[model samples]
Structure formats: C-alpha cells, structure tokens
Target: MTYLYPQIIFSKLFGACLLASLMLLAPLTAQAEYGDVVLNNRAEQSGMRPVIFPHWFHRIRFKCKVCHTEVGFEMRAGANDILMADIIDGKLCGKCHNNKIAWGPQNCHLCHSGLPGLKTGIRGGDSTGGPGKW
Candidate 1:
C-alpha cells in the first residue's frame, strides 16, 4: 500500500482550485468593454480629440502579442510614442490602419473622440469596490 503525505495532498488541491478560479474569471474579464485606454499624448497638442482605444474591442479580433510584440506597441499605457507622421509613414498604428487591413486615419473621429485633456491611461475603475470590477 502507498501513503500520500497531507501537505502534498493539500498542495495539489490548492493548485486545482487556483486553476479553476482563473478559468471562471476569464469570461468576466473579457466582458469588460469599458476598459478603454485614452491616448492623449498628442491629440490635445495637435488640436484633435484624444484617442479612446477600447482594449476589449481589439482583444476580440487580435491577441495581445499581435500589438504588444509583432506590432511593437508598448504594453504599458501611454508608453509608446505613437505619432501621426509615423503612423502615416507605415509605423505604429499605420501598421494596420493603413486603409488596407483596417480603416485608415481618414476618419479621425472614429478614434480621436475622447474628451479633451483626458490623460493617457485606462478609463475603467473599481468605483464599487467589488472584486474584478475593471
């Protein structure tokens, strides 16, 4: 007969519970459409409305690695130095928004529709103090 230690059994149970919790929370995180990121680095300076990039909307079509790795967008909010000239020259946003893969910058209001001086960062917040609000 073989005997298992109590600590070993506890660890195995803990690991299983953690994995299950993550699986259950995955869908909730995906439902957060309000997690928009405000890119006001140059919008206000350039006389345009700030860009309200919905992180959730983009996540549905592409994975994080697509933009954060292959497309070269910094993972941190407001970290990438995205410029209109660079984008128009086929860099940063222009990688896909070049009127081919996706809509081009011609429709400025489509992206640059955030309020003035909105600052660069996430828009959603845990106002209710609930778990996983944002």
Candidate 2:
C-alpha cells in the first residue's frame, strides 16, 4: 500500500504537468495569420474615400468567394476598381448593401466617412501602426 501511494501521486503529477503543457502550447499553435489589405495611394486619391478592407473582419461575416468571386474582387488591393457609381448600380458593395441584406449605399458616410477607425492609428489593434502586444 505504501508503494502504491507513491505511484499514484507520481501519475497524478505527470498528468497535471501534461495538461498544463498542452494549455500553454494551445494558444501558440492556434494563432492564425490574419492577412492585411493595403489601401493604395490610388484609392486614397480616388476622391471618394480611403477604404481599408480587413480580411479578418469580413471573414467573420462572409466567405472569401463572396467578394473574391461573386463580386469579382481581385486578390490585390486597388485592383477591384470599385467606384461609387458601380455601387449605386448594385455592384461591388451594393450587391450586399441592398438594405435587405446589409446597409445600403444610400447612407454615403457609412463607408465614405474618410475617418480612420479600425484601419488607422486612431483605433487600437491596427497593424498599420507599430506592432504592439496584441
């Protein structure tokens, strides 16, 4: 019985250590690379608004094909050639922002506010700014 007690305690300690090691490794392994899209100078000078599209944020709402295929958006930024008129004509963002699905383009400021929020340094977690401890 005395010998069995030591074995039991050793097994329990080993299991606890294993569990703790797994917990510590899980976060490091689970970290995902959220790619970024740059709003180019062309987009900035478009006179409409500078739109910085975050792949991470949109990934939560819709699939990649929704914009990439259905909307004919190129993988490269500023390649889509998105224009306000096209949106008004039910193209690009207007495809989803029909008011039935998402917010329509009737409210111009929703997207064209030109105020930097998530993409700019004004809001935190923006990679454009210096990388800090997330």
Query: Which prediction has the highest lDDT against the true structure?
Result: 1
Clashing residue pairs in candidate 2 are none
RMSD vs true structure, all candidates: 9.7, 13.3
Model 2 bad stretches (over 4 Å) = 1-47, 113-134
- lDDT scores for all predictions? 0.80, 0.62
Separately for all candidates shown, the number of backbone clashes (residues 3 or more apart, or on different chains) is: 0, 0
Error of 1 at 79 (Å): 0.7
* Candidate 1 Cα errors over 4 Å, as ranges: 1-32, 127-134
Candidate 2, residue 103: Cα displacement in angstroms equals 0.7
**Candidate 2's residue-wise lDDT over 30-122, tens digit each?**
322345444434445655555545577778999999988998877765456666788889998889888978889887655654443223212
Looking at candidate 1, what is the lDDT of residue 23? Answer: 61
TM-score of every prediction relative to native? 0.68, 0.52
Clashing pairs in 1: none
